[model samples]
Target chain A: MGLVPRVVVDVMPKPEILDPQGKAVLGALPRLGFSGVTEVRQGKRFELQVEGEVTEAVLADVHRMAEMLLSNPVIENFEVRVEETA
Target chain B: MGLVPRVVVDVMPKPEILDPQGKAVLGALPRLGFSGVTEVRQGKRFELQVEGEVTEAVLADVHRMAEMLLSNPVIENFEVRVEETA
Candidate 1:
């Protein structure tokens, strides 16, 4: 067996897009009997499982992928968290 | 005007799903003379912009929304980071 590396990617609105979904859901909140919510916007997330030993070098390569291929720096930012399974 | 709150949502692989897209991209690496990458997986990310004063209480409502509608608990998880803009 080998150690697996996983990376979590989070993407969000740039604060420019009119969040209709967020608003629609927010408007429905009171009807749902949940009046606590005031405003809502939704985001997307990604999970990746990698192979090989967990090392900073390995992670850097993954980070490069996130920056280059996986995530867009213009409207999104991402952080990588490695899971333990040895 | 009020401070706008934003949450960055990241979703990724469960480590169980066979990541074909990730693999296809990885397999193409060597052709580009980039032999470093061996395996890869893809994921989705979301960005949300919220309205109102950014406070712990306000964020609590937003957090609850994430748990309720924005994300799935099984095979998925989320984290909240509020942006500051006054």
Candidate 2:
């Protein structure tokens, strides 16, 4: 089972939620001379390696995991993208 | 003063930092049939519109802000790139 599986999951807090980290970072732009940057939202990207054909079951499971465990459903939304063999 | 400056700030936690969120997402890959990706480190990308010429001084200020305020240097490293007028 040397098959290497990779997955990229990108998740971000919804616009309504207050992302202190993102806000603090966004605010610092002008003071640092990055004057025109606006609307900075922080997110997550994940890459993984797995085994088996890319099936709906696998995608569903990953999505479920993201919604129920990996990310906070109340404030964060996640997207899971799967890729096989690099 | 309608010049637009776009800045992409990509920052990531140093390898040593334990990213639970990233790890959880990485772990879910096999369950999702994504079996080729490895070493997924999360980072930030900032796009901004600012006013002024791309000068060394501007770059320096952005760099300093990223290090001192925007990003947590103890756990994060960032790169500031500036583009003027779209």
DockQ of all predictions against the true structure, Cα-based: 0.30, 0.29
Q: What does candidate 1's lDDT look like per residue over B33-52, in tens digits?
A: 44445456565444445444
Per-residue C-alpha lDDT of model 2 across residues A1-86, encoded as one tens digit per residue? 55455555556787689877667777766665556445566655444334455567767766775676556888987778865552
Task: Give the docking tier of candidate 2.
Answer: acceptable
Model 2 agreement with the true structure over B1-86: per-residue lDDT tens digits: 57555555656677789877567656765676555435555555444333445567756766776677657999977768765542
Question: How high is the lDDT of residue A61 in model 2?
Answer: 60
Chain B TM-score, all predictions listed? 0.62, 0.78
lDDT of each: 0.59, 0.62
lDDT of 2 at A3: 47
> Residue B16's C-alpha lDDT in candidate 2?
86
